[model samples]
Target: MSVSHETRDGVAIVTLQNPPVNGLGLATRRGLVEALAHALADASVEAIVVTGGARAFSGGADIRELNRPESGMEPTLPTVIAAFENSSKPVVAAIEGLALGGGLELALGMHHRVAGSRAQIGLPEVKLGLLPGAGGTQRLPRAVGLETAVNMIISGAPVAAGKLAQSRLFDRVVDTDVVQAAIEVAKEAAASGELHKVRDWTVEHPEAAVFLASARTAVAAASAHYPAPLRCLDAIEAAVNLPFDQGIETERAAFADLIQTPESKALRHAFFSERAAGKIADVGADVAVREVKQVGVVGAGTMGAGISMNFLNAGIPVTLLETSQDALDRGLATIRRNYEGSAKKGKLTAEQVEQRMGLLTPTLEYADLKHADLIVEAVFEEYSVKESVFSQLDAVARPGAILASNTSTLDVDRIAAFTGRPQDVLGLHFFSPANVMKLLEVVRGKATAKDVLATVMALSKKIGKTAVVSGVCDGFIGNRMIEQYSRQAGFLLDEGALPQQIDRAMEAFGFAMGPFRMGDLAGNDIGWAIRKRRYVEKPHMTYSKTADLLCELGRYGQKTGAGWYDYRPGDRTAHPSQLVNELIERHSTDIGLVRRAISDGEIVERLVYALVNEGAQLLQEDIASKASDIDIVYLAGYGFPVWRGGPMFYADTVGLDKVVAAMRRYGKGHEGAAWEPAPLLLQLAEAGRTFNP
Candidate 1:
């Protein structure tokens, strides 16, 4: 909804009244169009000021509508922008907070743009497998020139209002009520007779061709599987060469094309899936979050230090507790070096680094945790070792302090059961190099309090991390899926496919890195340790004999210069090892398995189906809230390509019935244990339903 009226001085003000992000949905779009039409109809009005509800000007097109094609609600952005550009009276955009995607396009249509102190603008359509279709491609180039426009659009990066003003995109930027400032600018522009069309503004960058060519190459390299970036480049090029109206038609055609694409559907699924992942089974929006001012970190190793870094970065004081001065000193030295290195790299200032360092108080005692409000343990993966840590933490940490474990593949329930305050115990599984990774799997044990989960979720955002709430299970969401993915890859290798062929297939399918390459990067010994642990716990559980053979040969990974692939010293390129190939051949012959050439299609389907099967199981068991949560984990943590959306989205494109038949066929050929389809997958497949549903 929006309000429109002619002011006393012949200036019309149009204010969007939608709450939250004010995403331009059907009603909001209709309201905007009507408001503009009313302003344009009034002969007394000399100029118009476009503003927003409260803080946020707009987030973008209402994402809900992106997938709801049957809504019959075309975004009013294109129509409103066309009217604004062709209006008789000057239209001034007054931006506050974020004006992103179609929101920026709306501003670009106006004769002048005035942004507030905290205003940010960008075209982030690429993130959602889209390019701006509402005159953004044509007008932005005219406003900011070609090079800067293409970079901003392709990267989907937001530029601050101050920075945008320097780019000469916005006519003026001020630290005042944007509406009033826009009104003043509107009056001056009207008086000066500056009511000219922005479309008439020529876009003549001397290096336009070079910039577009470079952008095409860069985008192709960065996004090999995704079509959105390439399509975005095409639209930008249309704006450069084609006339204004033709560019607009080109944009519309491109947008319509993307709307029908599987990539767009998948990406849209991911966007909603991340939002849905925050919803917990027992926890509601009304759940209260605890006030955590001070934090206690146990085991100051790599995980512990990185976890503590997040706390300090969030401006929370931390008490880093270790067993010995030598260990504590090493942790402290690593923390200092990390911060100093960041400062050297221009990521942080020396002053900021010093300030963060001041927040940390390292102690070689459990007693130091007494005053802490939240205590997180990042000790060894052994349950007994973790139990001991939790027992001491429960005794010393203040009442109401949340006890968290950074265990990637351990049972959260077992750890919580060992503690007296089980209700306050939960799992905070941070991905490797925790400080760098954005995904944090927040596992809820049987007794984890609602407030505890909320606090952790809020804290994840505070530290610039996306927390996916998961029900406690061995490996939780991510590792469990990876287990299946790894199995599929190993099976492919055991069959006729080489490591190089398997890696190339997966990477070509849009994965940033293949399982083998990823394994090498993280060290193969990690998986070996996990497998060894699992086999010890449950001897009946299935174990891959192939990985064990590789481990036995001391082929760890890139760190050891050998794994499935050989790593050249000082180089990251993973080449298929002849030694590994020979070993696999001998092992296959020993096991009475005949090697046969495998197609890339078979490799892709096997690995993808493995992930899809596990994802279905997770969803059925309520380990994950939705199929999208699994996708988010893979996309953010496991380098699953953003364009394919995630494993489940890919499954939908493949068709559930087909996946079920393939899994059944494979299961029959192998043992039932080898290629068993998840019951959920079977159920959905039988019903002819998709995982996305």
Candidate 2:
């Protein structure tokens, strides 16, 4: 049974028993209803207390059941809540840990609520591009007034029980043994013969008409790309204007509409994809993870310092190594500056700044990292530099210590070959500004042990990273797919679209920044250097010379205040450059090509489909375990819009058939070979299947 029923001295206790967070799945809902019925029918039981154990009351609805037929199963959350409302026996909710989304809605159905002070409460379905569908919208305003309910629902952030205690949501706030206190409350309420229902309460807003009108305007502006937030406002407005039952009906109708929207579908896909990314195909729960108590970092450059901060923030001590005292001092200063900045912004306490800095041991010797549990080399991205560091680590490091390379694009297997114990060597490729970005590509070398991969994957969570396992490949998952995306962006520049036009189109499609703007911010010289290497290695690979020309003219990017677009000193905004525009026009004329008008639709399709095609290729090669894993890599790491899901999910939504057809059309263009659809994409398209399916 998902719920257990017991009684003591005429007080019945019903406990929700789902592990983790007691999600309101079909079985759990059925169990709750059955338990409630049993309590009401029992002769010995006069009052009832419904509680979830120390972990959670219920986190909400089961995400796995979303959009599935089983979501509409009998004894739905609304039906179960109605049963609570109509019960003869007083039902008091004893909430601990969390009561969120449908979980809080369930608690609101009870006659009274008593919560542990530490318990968190909210209706947070908006994060999943949804409103609280199970009467949360209609009932929350009645419990916590209109404005507070609107802010909570729209933001999808939780409030602590202690904070909401005076809001009348909970009848009593207890610091200890919430269930026992709730049982006492239930017994008293039963004796009083009075049941308090949230539905019987009226939502009072003095300036209802003016406030809701202003709120609708604010919501529309803040949620321009999303439909759910606007719908959420409408539901809240109904709560203020209509009667209780009418407001509930309006909320249900709005929720049903938002659930079917494309934006909601994409958001839901991202939600599940993040959870799915953590599971390894071969690694079992029983796999032993190496203890990463102490971390050592080589090369105290920008990447090294950022990488070291992740461990330090997690309260792990770090030993930072550099070639010279000056380099070590500079790196340490940068780390301190970063922490101080966070402290200034109220993100960290001043004591936390010193605490993290105190953990760092900066040195110029390789011997200091010998006893380290895990050593990460964030040296230059050159083979010789990586070889020297790994060889030195192999000589001095303890036998079982894990050796990790923070190389974004180097061959992990080749780097592992430098160490004596290949089983302990792997890649921990962190994205730029490592402490901020959540994506960590855990690249698995051929000889890498299951425990090592499992350890890093598990450790990623400790460091607050979303780790995606990748097989040994040229660029791993994110950078490899991004190479194609960048190539297409370059091709678009050479064709007809200018830098700003391309960036604007992509931004309109919901990307935080367009390719040209992103390239400028990331330093265009970085890609120029990568291309210089590729020019020698893969001579047949085609690319636009526009970026190279920009680099030739000493426009390296924001560091130089110029690249595809110009930047003023101290401002990161990209302003249109007449020199860059003339450079692009001159390049087009020099190449004997006529620049034609390119539609924004064509630009968006080409750029996004480029990623989709490359992702399908990665799937074909088995570099990525699943399609959703690729989505997680892009969504978390590459600034792929969460509202569009990952490239794979977006492609599926666009229909694989349409994507393949677009690819075939693009294949006939100038750089035709690059646009040729991946075999997997073609196969899926022919079979009328989706990448996610």
Candidate 3:
């Protein structure tokens, strides 16, 4: 790592050159200090401008070096910010691409910030289970005020230079070259010869203290198991209440404290794990992915319309095939309404909506899709319909044209085998409301060609979705885990815990929505449909008897105004129904099992252990590549909070031995239920090792 200083017409340029992200590691930090010394000592250099070569300004402090004992040499970011602040000349920042985490913190230190048109700025330390360690807490509050700062820091969202300028986060936004803009700003400042000091900028609306307090409460409520967001609030509060130096000290202390936490370590592990997810061991980067300029969709229901929208929204033309003109019209109307609603909500302009709408072409014939580079079948769950659709798609679509299915639970290999071109067939399992959900489980069939896998994975990213590759299995990664997790929730209900108690415990565990609440929102009938099919295959095995009973009574969740709880028409909030409680009591009594009072800890353990146990099974079977992949699936597709890391990461934090013990206890107490500890969980418990390691 090195930082070079160059002077031209009273403007000093400081370039941070650390390969890759240019993270503020030991060498980079020391080099930065030396560069600042050169700029500040020069008599002719009136202003200093800093920028990074290549794309990223910096990702963050080098994770590989952060906690290394030998690197006591790691220059704490606060010290470097102090140097930037005490400089005689106004410090300007010229950011090209991404300025994230500590990168954004360093930018906050400068007196003036100018970025290129596409430059994005964000403090994403929260994603790593941390807050900005440098004086970002103090300075950003001074720049964008309290509320905006809190939202950005908590959400870990980055915005373009234009938005940043509108929000006044930057002193100026430049469309031309950033380095040139910085030089001009420096020269203009030198001509004026005005004393420019960031510290002297008084914070307006001192009542921002109230805003900080409210934000703290919201953070605490949002982050129960995760410590970073709440810790971030403490630093922001210090900025509001304490002196600049004291606030800096407080921010450093809080940052140091969080870096040592297990939550942070797990989250940091997850961060690197996700980047590694796309890189398969056998597949090299040279694997040729077929170009997919146009796509074709079969079926015309909600799933097909949503699938078409995803392709169209990504600026890819889609040819939608249906059996009749009526079905095509219905599908087209749904697509139109979806885009029109988005336009009305300001997510898209009317003209932009029309442009996107024009990308869709509906046809009642399969021959029209002959030119499509990729074709996806999004028909009903019935294997016959899917098989027939794939057969037709194989005949019509050109050779080497990738064939895919949006089947959630169907066997991908079976679907692949239905068509003559098995190597070209794969499963692109998009979640319901495909265009909205972030996760798309790209199921690799036994005969799925490498090129086909590569193309779908790339396409998934192009459409703004995180795709996790999985082997052909019953439910892939997310649903496979959900099957066990939801089963445990149902078991808890039979064993004595109410839906409210289960939901509460899970919420406390950092899930955005619990199983019962999720069931209510998704309509419990979906599980009923799948469960009926599953029960047919496993006739002898014992399963939860209460869920079907609830459905039998016409409680199909929020849709019918009744399910786990009674709904008030359009309202989302849940209230327990006496009828459901009576049903639970009757079921418990019919089974001759005592419905004893269950503790909150028991509710949490049973539910979480069920999922963790399944994740272990997935790991053992190689359905999930790593322990963190399961976490990513849950974090993105499910409502698993990022701060707690994910279910598997949380399990490691809770300890494997404890999970094994709970599983054993629950299995013993609830006879005939599927609450057994997974073999991998038992093995790890015996060895006393964490899943993440």
Candidate 4:
């Protein structure tokens, strides 16, 4: 049983037995109801005290059970709460570690709640695109004041019980044992003979209407399109206007409808996919991991400096190596400037910044990295540049040191082959502005050791990164899929679509920036270099010449202050460039291509479906172990819309059959070979299956 019953003195103690933040599944709910019934029937029982161990009161509903039919079976969370409400004996909640989502709602139902001062409490269902489906929306405001409950429910962030010690939600917030404190509260409640039902509590506010109106504007402005924040406010407002029963009905109705929304499904998928990305298919937790006490970074440019910040912030010392004293000084200065910028914003203290900066050892010598545990090469993104760096590391690095290449496109296996210890060499492909970004693509090479992979994965989490493992391949996962997306964006530009039109469509569809604006920000020279290589390696492939023309004109992006769009110095805003648009028209004419009016729908489909098709192919090739892994990469690294999920999940929601039809329709146009659906995508569509399911 997930619920255990025992009697201390004349009080019946009910403990939630499910381990690791006792989730309220069907069995747990059933056990709770049965225990309440048992306590009510007992002749000597004076009061009932409910508790989940010291680690957690409850984390909430068993997320694994959320999709199951049994989740809504007979003894639902509401039914168990009803049992407590109907009970003659006083029911008290002993909250220890955390009470979140349904867990907080459960605590709210008890006649009295006794919590440890350090316990975390909140209703965080909004993060899953939900309002608390139980009675949280109604009771929270009545238990705590209106503003506090509204803030907690809407933000979905935890608050310490100690902070809420003055709130009525907890009868006593103590430093001592919470269960024992609850027993005493239970005895007091039993003697008082008062049914302290939250439903009877008044949700009072002097300026209710004005407060709700202001909140609506704030939430709407915060997320212009997301429905949850506003929907949550709607439910909370119901608690203020209507009775508890009506408010609960409103919350339940909102939850039911929200679960069916595409936004909610996408949010739920993202939540699960991120957690799943940490686990490698073959490498178990039992795998041995190397200690990474000291880190060595080659190259002292923007990337090397950012990479060094991640380790220094994690309290690991780093030896930042550059070719010259001048370059090393510049890199060190850049790191300090970033830290100072953070301090100016009050995100870091001056002393804290110095503590992080102190961990760094800037050097011009490769021999200085001999004793380091891991050496990450963040030098220039060229084979020869990496080859020289790795050769020096192979010669100078200790016997057990792990060597990593921060190569975004270059093959990890070939990079590993340059070193004598192939097992210790792998690609740690960190996105640009490495410390700021959450995604870390861990590329596994042909001969990379299992322990080496495990160690890097662990270290990635320690440094606050979502690590997704990728098999050795050109561009690994994100870059490979993005290449196709970029190609489609170019094709759109050639077919009478302006850079602004294409970028606006993508941005409207949830991408952080349109391909053109992104190119301008990331530097147009980067794509030109890739296209330059593609011209020799993939001569048969078709690509728009407009981008090449833009780069050739010395418009290398923000660095040059011009590319697809013009930029003014000291302002990051991109202004439409007539020079670039005229160039696009000339290129289309030079290619003898007729410009057709392209719909925003067509632009979005072409760009996004291109990514979906390539991702499916990667899944088929085993370059990616799972579809969810690919989704994680895009969601984390790329600014794929969270509301739409990743491209793969979005495809499933759109219906694969429809996606294939769209691709087939696009195939009739230029570069038809690239638009052909992957065999795996076609197979799944025919079988009526989904990529993530």
TM-score per candidate: 0.94, 0.98, 0.90, 0.96
lDDT tens digits, residues 359-439, model 3?
Answer: 999999999999999998889888999888988888888989999999988899999888899999989988878879888
Question: Per-residue alpha-carbon lDDT of model 2 for 46-162, expressed as tens digits?
Answer: 999999999998998897898888799888899999999888989999999999999999999888999999899998888888898878888888888888898899999998989
> Order the candidates by lDDT, highest first — what do you get?
4, 2, 1, 3
Residue pairs in collision within model 2: none
Q: How accurate is candidate 2 locally (lDDT)?
A: 0.91
- Candidate 2: list runs displaced more than 4 Å: none
> Which regions in candidate 3 have their CA more than 4 angstroms from the true location?
1-12, 18-21, 34-48, 53-56, 63-65, 69-72, 83-91, 143-155, 159-172, 187-197, 206-230, 261-270, 568-575
Best by TM-score: 2
Stretches of candidate 1 exceeding 4 Å from the true structure: 1-9, 37-45, 67-75, 166-168, 568-572
RMSD of 3: 3.2
Q: Name the TM-score of candidate 4.
A: 0.96
Clashes of each: 0, 0, 0, 0
TM-score ranking from best to worst? 2, 4, 1, 3
Per-residue C-alpha lDDT of model 4 across residues 1-693, encoded as one tens digit per residue: 799999999899999999888999998999999888888889899999999999999999876777689878978888878788778999999999999988988888889999998999999888888789889999999988889988999999999999999978889999998999999999998898987898899887899889999988899899675788889999999999998888889998998888878888889999999989888888999999999999999988999999999999999999999999999999999999999999999999999999999999999899999999999999887899888999999999999899999999998888888889999998999998998998999999999999999999999989999999999887899999999999998888887999999999999998988898889889989989988998998899778888888888999988888888898989879999999889998888888889999999999999999999999999999999999898999988899988888999999999999999999999998778888789999999999999988
Q: Model 4 misses residue 15 by how many Å?
A: 2.6
lDDT of 1 at 64: 78
Over the full model, what C-alpha lDDT does candidate 1 score relative to the true structure? 0.85
Q: Write the per-residue lDDT of candidate 1 for residues 283-359, one digit (tens) a residue.
A: 78889899999999998899999999999998999999999999999999989999999999999999999999999
